[model samples]
Target chain A: MMCGDEYRESLRRLKPEVYYLGEKIESVADHPAFIPHVNSVALTYDLARAPEFEELLTTKSHLTGEKINFFTHVHHSCHDLVRKVKSLRALGQQTGSCFARCVGHDALNAIYSVTYDLGKKNGTEYHQRLVNLLKEVQAKDLFLSGAMTDPKGDRSLSPSQQKDPDQHVHIVARKQDGIVVRGAKAHITGAVNAHGHLVMPTTSLKEADQDFAVCCYVPIDTPGVIHIFGRQTNDDRKCSGCLIDQGNPEYGIVGGEALIVFEDVFVPWEHVFMCGEYDFAFDLVERFATAHRQNYGGCKTGLADVLTGATYALAEVQGTVGASHVRDKLVEMVHLAETLYCCSIACSCQGYALPAGNFMADPLLANVTKLNVTRHVYELARLAQDIAGGMLATMPSESDWKNTSVGKYVDKYLKGVADVPAETRMRLLRLIEGMTCGTALVESMHGAGSPQAQKIMLMRRANWEHKKRLAQKLSGTGESRHD
Target chain B: MPGQKRRVSLKYCGSCNPLIDLSRIGQVLPAAISQETDLLFVSAEETNIDTIIILCGCPRACGNKETIRARALRCIVVAGESVDAVPVAEKDISTAIIKKLKPK
Candidate 1:
């Protein structure tokens, strides 16, 4: 795997046509606004080489017999599945935010797991195509962003019924060499920095929606592709001359999201993984969603750990760390965060092997993990905010703290506990504010699909009929009515 | 001593979240150690050294320890509040490294 510096150089080499605030961004890796997010992405590479994290971050490739970053690895067994969550948590805590690599990792496993079944059913070579791609990715130690989540125009309609045909990415034309696709993928995490994309259908499709069921892999900087960076709150602060105002300056608060439009991008035959596999679209979506849901346990809880640390740090600076209420809040924050961690581990441990020999996390438990992540992450953030006090909201900007005229006043009055500098307090509070505010909460709510999506999946997988039978048997009325 | 030579490879992780500056090891110990023992930079792809010294920026020890082969492995983790080394030092790192390299 590339080190952090090499990863940066690799990103700089990309010729992606990216835009930020209506202006063209020539080099995403060099842009100030994108640097923090790039740094977040870069950590995934560096940590893989890091001695302490190597066990969890690097694994032996099954196809190539070479060492590869865990992000590019297929789950070989249940232990690999458990290690996935552990590594995500470690990276999450280190970055104190979404590292952005997990999305691609999750999507890779989903595609790798489902293609074998698809091949068995249809006599397709999709599984071998994916295996070849996996070998290449492992050899290069590259990042492949999982591109799903289309910009569906109407909530009630399917892909085929949409007024704007391009709302969901589709195979628009069939070429002699391969096929051409045109459409967009929205809220894609780490797309700007990825080496390529593993594009999949975002929704279940009918026979009429066969064109939209196309799944393929494409390089990020290919001709006819355009990326528009999505704005995050306080992003400008990261690009600001003053650094502390943007908390977690070393890493970003959430995955840097972008909207990528594929303008009739051409794909050769070797890279066209799945073409018009409409019936398997649901399987792909379910596998991807469940794997992604399990990740909430791994990454979100890591973020919760950082928030807990920030809360405790603030309490220390304010000299209220010893207060029973402050201590209680810290315990509560840990409780919620750990509960999410438990969900992640439980799902992974319950994972089973698919036909492709790739392990898939338990669908029911994975959904449960994500559902808990939805509620507990906010509650943990709330407890952290409570422990941090009101200053997180009312604190003056870093500029005021360093300004010439009023600087002295801020230094004098804003000081908490004798030893902690006013600037230190402000720095901690800024970080606390950056994460707990609207951005993180929104991501936790909507990133891996919304809470409602999880509930729906859970409903489908609940096995209510079996449960009813068990209830009857326990109540000594089993089969009485049937007879 | 009859021309006994020892090669040591050094590696450093990017100081993303260093508790203390990790460059001090290179600054203070490299020159002295190079005089008594061979100091080298091993590519992640190569493993020719007799000893590996991982200079980590913090307790996280964020370096590729796996497959980075050597006869002996030692780490110096520069933590936020403390300096944790494999063999505790009582003086300048150069003198300590020299002592370690040239055993009596």
Candidate 2:
């Protein structure tokens, strides 16, 4: 496993074209806006080295049989899928926010299976190339940002029909040595902090859109690669000295997504895992979605647990802890939170091995889990705000609370109950506001896939005709039905 | 009256709540509001209050226009909605009713 210092050094070496607040980030690892997210990624590396978490966080690489970070390991069994969820939940609980590595973790598993199947069908050596890449990733324990979701210009247009051909990431040229790609991947989590990026096709392609169906790996600092970090709600809090104002001060919201622009970047032939394999693109996207959707149950539920705990504490401090109504509201929150957890676990338990021998989560259930998440996570956050009360939004800034003139007055007036300090209530409310009303909730809604995406998958996978036939048989409403 | 036991049931189903204490009152108040109330006070925002007044006066027998108007005015105040000017007595009466029925 990579050491924390080594990870920091590696990031320092990368001359990534990263911008934050409209200015270029000279040193992302040390920047205040990016440091917390970097530290969260560092934990992924640090945890693998721990003796207690070795089993769950580290796994024997399928290629070398050497123990590697679980993020770099291929799923060899159903146990691996379960372990992945468990490990992510543990990380989520520790961070109290997105750790930003699950995308790469799920992406690797997906490409592993899809590439193998593609090679089997097309007689391509992409699978072997991927295995070689996996060995290198294992040896280095590299942190990779899975870059998907191209800058789709129009919702109704396909990659070929787009007014701007570059709106979707596509291979610009095929050189003798390798291929060159151009375009941008938007909302890429951990792009600025990662050592490398695993670029995948965003959606399925047709024969006409062959160039758009491309996948490869490239270092973040590769020449011509530029990163423009997307702003999060209350992102300015990173510069603020108050820890409470920045909820989960040690880990920022949802991996600090960035728009990664590839301006004719070259990919070595070995690194180019999928080039113009249009038929396999959909499978790859679906598999990636499955692994990622399974992750929501684990990580988001862990976040919901933190929100629930914080809300409960807020209630206690407000002298409403003993109220039956308060107790019931909390109970309802717990129920919804645990319901999400159950979906995650259920999907994991129902996982099966892909043809390439990597375990994949059940597609229908995983999609359902994510679908339920898009709704309930928001509801949970709303309920948290309700229990936390308007004070969460109206609390005084930590700096003002510390001012000499106003400090005493704030302390005197803002005290929730006699026992709890005014600062404590302010801190709790700030944290609640940060999580509920900010980027955290939006990330929960849009990340993985939106509710509409999951509903589409659920409709496609649902056995509606079978249900209709069964209903006809039981109700004797059909012409051919026998009682 | 001391010996008699009464049970009442109130059902609330909708998207928004103008009564801030409706949830609390539902839990703390007895069932008499649902069952034993010969006079039903329909509290709603002004946007819907006028409609409630019309329906209650026309279709329902137990509905009292004064009580409905008072409740409606109270809800309007709570929801920050516009309503016709309230008489001094009506304002005091509604405020008193709210304080008694939905105490903070």
- Number of the top TM-score candidate: 1
Model 1: per-residue Cα lDDT over A83-144, one tens digit each: 78878887887888888888888888888877888888888888888889888888877888
| Candidate no. 1 TM-score | 0.85
Q: What RMSD does each model have against the real structure? A: 5.4, 20.4
Model 1 interface Cα RMSD in Å: 6.9
Interface root-mean-square deviation, each candidate: 6.9, 21.7
lDDT of 2 by residue, A1-483 (tens): 787778988999888999988899899999999988998888878877653344458767778888788888788777677767777766776677888888988888889999889988998888888888888888988888999899899979889899888999999999999999999999999999998899999888998889999999998899989999999988898987768778668887778999999999999999998989888899999999989999888888777777888899989889988989888889989898778877887888899988988889889999988988888888998889888887777777778778999989889888988988987788778767877886888788889878888887889889997988888878877845444
Regions of model 1 farther than 4 Å from truth: B1-104
Best by DockQ: 1
Model 2, span B1-104: residue lDDT tens = 34332222222221011213333333333332333333233334223232222111011121233644443333222121112223223224324333334324
DockQ computed for model 2 against the true two-chain complex using alpha carbons: 0.01
Chain B vs. true chain B: TM-score for each candidate?
0.60, 0.24
The TM-score obtained by model 2 is: 0.80
Candidate of highest lDDT: 1
